[model samples]
Target: MNENAESLSRRLIRNFNTAPTTHDVREPLYDSIGARLAPGTAAQKLGASIDTVAPGKMSCPYHFHYAQEEMFIILEGSGTLRVAGEMLPLRSGDVVFIPPGPEYPHQIVNTSDQPLKYLSVSTREQPEVCEYPDSGKFLAMASAGGERVFDVVQRRSNDLDYWDGEP
Candidate 1:
């Protein structure tokens, strides 16, 4: 294997050992969602896993990838899928796919009273830029300084573009 691949594998194992297996509360976007990322697994590029969310919680913010494609297969409970511009109901045994594009800002929200469980799979090497259209937030991965951030609105001074004068 290549050096980078070997290094990533080692890092993944280390992260799995050190990272918390489960979080008690939901993350940045969800109200009551919690996740348990499987250790030593790479879901984004190499495919990592095992996500659980509580009722009224969201799997993620409404966002779309630039290069990565993601798939979610429901294992339990029910939820609502906000994809493209529509909200569709989802339940156990349901499968949803989000392809790379700005047209689909996808997210899952649990409306049922029980916990929601699912397995998410994706390719490891994809460079992705995600945008939350409703919130006007954008995040770009694979950048040198880590995640790049942007706002979706025009600035007060129309004379300059968004990234033209920033540090």
Candidate 2:
């Protein structure tokens, strides 16, 4: 097969079960496999991924985005959607919409004995800021050319004055 033939065949089509894994987190509280699906296609303004979280784990901390909105489509198993200090039960076929801002800080907790799988979609907003309430930290990230150029995480208590470095 020609080089272009193989590339074109897989560019626009993908199965979540067989998608290429982009990230696998096995931290103490986080255990998940993220399969990025949008990067394989021509999508520029949106991002999509399928994440499978192991039982009794979560994919990320309770955080809220400042610029990008997100949606989650539960595909298999059951979990708990922890949002804004509330614990909401989640099951297969559940659709969740999270708007940007601290008012909707959220995280997925796999409360089931089986792996919880969901399709996560979000706006590809640059120079995004995410605040983690539980950790008292925040993340600032920026990307260019489909690559991350800047990513920083700092605690809220360590913030500097606007003119700290100014003459």
Which residue runs does candidate 2 get wrong by more than 4 Å?
1-10
Candidate 2, run of 10 with poorest lDDT:
19-28
Q: Which sections of candidate 1 miss by over 4 Å?
A: 1-20, 24-44, 143-167
TM-score of 1: 0.66
Q: For each candidate, how many residue pairs have backbone atoms clashing (under 3 Å)?
A: 8, 0
Candidate 1 C-alpha lDDT tens digits along 91-113: 99998887778877888888788
Q: Report the Cα lDDT for candidate 1.
A: 0.67
Per-residue alpha-carbon lDDT of model 2 for 123-146, expressed as tens digits?
999989999998899999999888
Q: For each candidate, what TM-score against the reference?
A: 0.66, 0.90
The local lDDT score (0 to 100) that residue 30 gets in candidate 1 is 73
Error of 1 at 7 (Å): 15
Clashing pairs in 1: 26-33, 42-47, 42-48, 43-47, 43-48, 45-123, 45-124, 46-124
